[model samples]
Structure formats: C-alpha cells, structure tokens
Target: MIDRFLDRLAALVEPTILALVIILLAWIVLRLTRATIQRAVARALQSERLSAREEAARVRTLTTLAESAVRLTVILLALLTILSIYGVPIGPLLASAGVVGLALGLGAQTLIRDVIAGIFIVLEDQYHVGDVIHVNNVSGSVEALTLRYTALRTLEGAYVIVPNGEIRIVQNLSRDWARAIIDVPLVPEEDVDRIIDILRPLLAALPSDPELGPLVLEPGEVFGVESIGQQQATIRIAVKTRPREQWRVARELRRRILYALREAGISAPYPRTVMIFHPSSPQPPASS
Candidate 1:
C-alpha cells in the first residue's frame, strides 16, 4: 500500500509543477502585454492633434479593450495547457468548443452585430461619453458605452439603453461648433429694413456682452425677409457659437429680440377676422 501511494504521488508531481509554471508564465505575459499596449497607444497618439482630455479618453478606451482581449486569450491558453498536462484529451475538447461556438454564433447574431458596431463606433470616434447626440429618434447625452449597448441620459432625466446595432444614424450635436438660428415674425406692414437695422446692432453687441462673449464665435448675421406671408414676414438671424451653446444662445437672442420689439412699439402679426353682416336672406325663407 505504501509503494502504491508513493507511485501515485510521483505521477502527480510533474504535471502539477508544470501547471503552476504555465499559470505563472501567463500572469507575467499578461502584465507585459498590457504595459506594451499602453506604451504603444500613448506613443501613437502623440502625433495627432487632440486635446489632453480627448487623448486620455481614447487611450483609456483602447487600452481597456486590448487588455480584455489579451487576458481572455491568455486565460484560455493557460487552461488548455493545464488540462493537457493532466492527460486530458485536447482534440475532443477543441472540437466541442468549435461546435459550441458555431451554435452560439448563430443563436446570438444580434449580439455579435452590436459588438461589431460598437467597435467601429469607438474606432471612428463617432461619439463619446458626455457627448450630446441624437440617435434612433432619441436625443441625449452619452452616459456610458460598451460592446453591446450605449446608455443615454436624456434632457428630461430619463435613462435609456440602446443596442449599438440599432444606431444607424448618429448626429453628434457637441462636436466642435454649433449655430443658433432665430426667426422673428412681424406684421407685414412693418418695414423689414428697419427691423434689420434694429437687430444688427443688438447682434453685433452680443460678442461684447460679459455673459455671452465667450460663447459667441462670430458676429450674428441677419438674413432679411426669409419669407413674406399674408399677415407676417419672417426675418432670419443666425449666430455661430461654441458647441452645445446654440440653444442657450438662441433662447437669449429670442428674449432680447422680444424686449426690443416691445420697446420699439412694433406689433407682432395676429390673425385678422372680417365679419360681413347681411340682411337675412331677404326674408324669402320665412314663408312658413
């Protein structure tokens, strides 16, 4: 019985030591690979013209993705190696894994598509976290992004999850710059040139205002007489502003324009009703 026990222990020692070594080697490889990827990404980004914040975000995103892939591969390889050392047949295991993978691929097509789309989104820099975007008829700020879905926080405080595969059109509202457009309607009898004259100075002075100066990118332009209708004429004014600032600028402009129009005693357009009074059908219908 003692000899039998000793023989079993001897048989286990080599495989156990080999498995430990393989695990240790995998750990070392993972650490080195992560460091190398970080260095490579940082070095590559130095040549691009990006803000410090943008650079950091991209680096972090890419490094995380690469690390995850590498870790998964290394772990699978280490597990296979450990199994083989224990005299487990690997051929059948590999065949079974392939079959399972094929089955999963067919079963999770949507998931695969979403992951692919997410990868492209990150690579193309379509949008990033904290960016205000319009996708799938929903306008919101990106709260988080992952391989399968993107989380959004709408202006109304609703949290939404959207599959990446469903995002066919992406409208990034906070890219670089934005435009503020305001249309002012007036009574048709009002002189458009006079209104433009009043608006020109107000718009020109926008860039000098303390609160709005930083947001304004260029002086406002008045596109006179966009359209003339029976009761009202539309005058369009546009201003270039910093990104995400267009709505605020537009609101401010509307308020200022309202006050100016009121102070100038200019009447806004209102529907007019005409009542025609006629004698009752000449009393022809009263023959009861």
Candidate 2:
C-alpha cells in the first residue's frame, strides 16, 4: 500500500511541476515580447514631432496592436505546448488548422485588407484623430482610429464609420495650415476698386487684433471682382490661417464686413421679385 501511494504521488507531482514551469516560461516570454515591442515603438517615434496628447494617442494605438499580435502568438504557442505535453498529436491538429485558416482567409479577406490598410495609414501618418479629412467622398473630423475603421464626426453632427480598405484617397483638410476663401456678392453698380479699398482697412487690422490674430497667419487680402454678373459682382476675400481656425476667422470677417458695409450705407445684392396682377388674378378689396 505504501509503495502504490508513493508511485501515485510521483506520477502526479512531475506533470504538475512541468505544467507550472511551462506556464511560467510562457508568462516570462510574453512580458519580454511586450517590453521589446514597446521599446521599439518608442525608438521609432522619437524623431516624430507630435504634440503631447497626439503622441500619447499614437503610442496607445500602435502598442495596442503590437500587444494584441504578441498575445495571440504567445497563446498559440502555450496552447500547443500544453496539448503536446498531454500526449495529443499536434501534427494532425496543425494540418486541420491550416485548412480552416485558408477557409477563413477567403471569408474574411476584406477584414484582413482593412487591417493591413490601417497599419499602413498609421505608419505613413496619412492622417490622425482630430484631423478634418475627406475620404470616400465623405468629409469630417476624425473622431477615432482603429485597426479596422475610422470614425468621423461630420459638421452636421453625424458620426461616420469608414473602413480603411475603402479609403483610396485621403484628403487632409487640416494639416499644417488652412485657407479661407469667401465670395462676397455686391451690387454690380458698385466700383470694384472702391469696394476693395473699403475692405482694405478691415483686412489690415485683422492680423493685429489680439483674439483673432493668433489664428490668422496672414492678413486678409481682397481679390477685386472675382466675377461680374447681371445683378451682382463676386468679391473674393482670402486669408491663410492655422489649421481649423479658418472657419472661425471667416465667420468673424463676415460679421465685421456686414456691419461695416451697413455703417457705410452700402447695400449687398439680393434677388428682386415683382408681382404682376393679371385680369384673372385676385386683388385686394377697395376701402369704402
């Protein structure tokens, strides 16, 4: 009875110790892999000129992807080792996995393509979160970026999700700088040169104002009479500004122009309508 008990204890203790060792090794390797990946990413991003918040976001995105890949590899290796330790033949399992993987590859090709495209986008720095971009005929500010899709918040408050694979062209609207070009329509009878002169003072003072000056990189310049029509003439006002600031600057300019023009007794152009009373048309009753 004693000999049988000793044999049973020995049989159980060896496999338990071996299994624990295998698990420990797997854990150590996972930690090392993660550390290495993080170190590599840090080194790669050292030369990138990014703001503190932007850098953090970029780091988070890339590291999350790297860690996910590492975790999958570690899990697969650990699972295989454990199965082998239990006397399960891995050769047939691997063969079956390859066949299934091929089938899944065919089924999820678009998913794979999207992830690959996303990786390239991140690497190339084509665009980032908070950038107003145009892709796949949709224009919006990027709200979030992932390995599969990009989320955008439109000006009208609509959220759009675009698959990375479908993004053939990426037009970044807010990159280093932005320009605002506005057409102000006026009476065709007004002198083009005189209108430009009237707008000159407002344009000159724009870049010197405290609040808006920072947003404006260049003072506004009015291009006289962009086009002439029967009723109105289009005057072009252009300004270079910091990224995303052009909208605010443009709005402010419009407000100032409207008030100034009103003070100067100049009227903007608008469509005119006339009512023709024909014989069959109804007319107002005559006062008694």
Candidate 3:
C-alpha cells in the first residue's frame, strides 16, 4: 500500500516539477531577449535628439511589443514541451492553432487596427503625454497613451478612453509657440499713430522684461486695425509665447493695456443712442 502511494505521488509530482523547470528556463531566455530588444530600440530612438517625453513614449511602445512577442513565444514553447512529455501529436495542434488564430484575428480586426495605428502614432510623435489635443471632438490633455488606446483627462476632469483607429484627425495645440491675440477698441477720435507709438515702445521693451523673458517668445506687435466702427476702431495686437502660454499672456496684456490707457487719459468709446418720436407724440397739449 505504501509503495502504491509513493508511486502515485511520483506520477503527479515529477511532471509538475519538470513543467515548472521548463517554464522558468523559458522565462529567463525570454527576459534576456526582451532586454536586448529594448536596448537596441532605445539606442535607435536616442539618435534623434528626442525629448524625455518622446523617449518615454518610445520605450513604452517597444516594451509593450517585446512583452507581447515574448509571451506568445513562451506560451507556444510551454505547450509544445508539455505535449511532448505526454506523447501527444503536435502536427494537428499547429494546424488547429492556425485556423483558430485566423478566426480570432478576423473577429478582432478593429482592435488590431487600433494597436497598429497607436504604434505608428507613438513612433511618429503625433502627440505625447501632457499634450493638449483635439481628437474627434473630444478635446483634452493626454493623460496616458498606449498601443491599445489613449486616455485623456477632459477639461472638466472626466477621463476618456479613445481608440486609436477612431482618431481621424489630431490637433496638437501645445507644440512650439502660440499666438496671444487681443483686440482693443479705442474712440475713433483718438490718434491711431499715438496709440501705435505708445504700444510700440512697450512691446519692444517686452522681450527684455524679466517677468516675461521666459514666457514671451516674441514681442507683441500691432497686427492691424480690424475695423473702424461708428464710435471706435478695433486695434489688433498679436504676441507669440511658448505653447500653452498664450492665454496667460493675453490676460496680462489686457490688464496692462487698460492701465496704460487710463494713465494716458484715453476714454474708450461707448455706444451712441438715437431717439425717434411718433407722429402722434410730436404735438404736445398746451398747459394752463
């Protein structure tokens, strides 16, 4: 009875131990290959003078690809190893896997497309984490980008997951520099040249201002007067700033311009009203 019990234990334990050993060895080999692949990809991307964000995106893409490949390889090897131990035929298994893979791939074509498109996006640097983008009317800052999909945090703080294939056009708003455009309306009677003259010196001095040295890429300048209304003319000023700083520059410029206008005693124009009387009210009754 003891001999039978020992035999049963051997039958169960030996195969399990052997399978585990093979799995461990396979995992080690896969890890080595994965590391090598990642290093090669990293070196290639580094030669492009990419920024840290770009580098991180590339590394993530490569790591994901490597992991997928390694997992598939390990799974196939483990299956083959176990089947050999059990004396099962592998020719039929390979044929069956081919058919099954084809069916599965067909059913998951959209997913595959999203993954492939996402890879291209990462490699091409279409956008990066922290970039503000407009993808299919879902505007937000990119919180995370992956081969499967992109995660964005909307301006309202909602998290949105967008499939890569569905993104037809990508508008990246935070690339280099953006324009800070403001239109100031002045009384038509005010001298245009005087306003321009006053603003020119201020704009010229802007580049050297310590407060604006880093934020302002270029000095503000009058683009042109857009329109002259009945009481006022709209003056257009444009400033170029580092990406995502346009709004800040605009607000600051507006505040400063208002202060300057007040200091100069320039009164901004206001709406003019015209009054008309009905024929019936044109004549008033004589008072006693």
Better of 1 and 3 by lDDT: 1
lDDT of 3 at 179: 83
108-170, model 3: which lDDT tens digit per residue?
A: 999999989988887777887777888988988888787889999998999999999898899
Each prediction's TM-score against the native? 0.75, 0.75, 0.74
Score candidate 1 by TM-score against the native: 0.75
lDDT of each: 0.90, 0.85, 0.83
What lDDT does model 2 reach?
A: 0.85
Q: TM-score-based ranking, best first?
A: 1, 2, 3
- Answer with 1 or 2, whichever has the higher lDDT: 1
Candidate 3: stretches off by over 4 Å: 18-42, 51-94, 185-191, 227-233, 266-288
Tens digits of per-residue lDDT for model 2 on 145-201? 877999999989999999999999899888878998888888988777777888989
- The Cα error of candidate 3 at residue 39, in Å, is 4.9
Maximum-lDDT candidate: 1
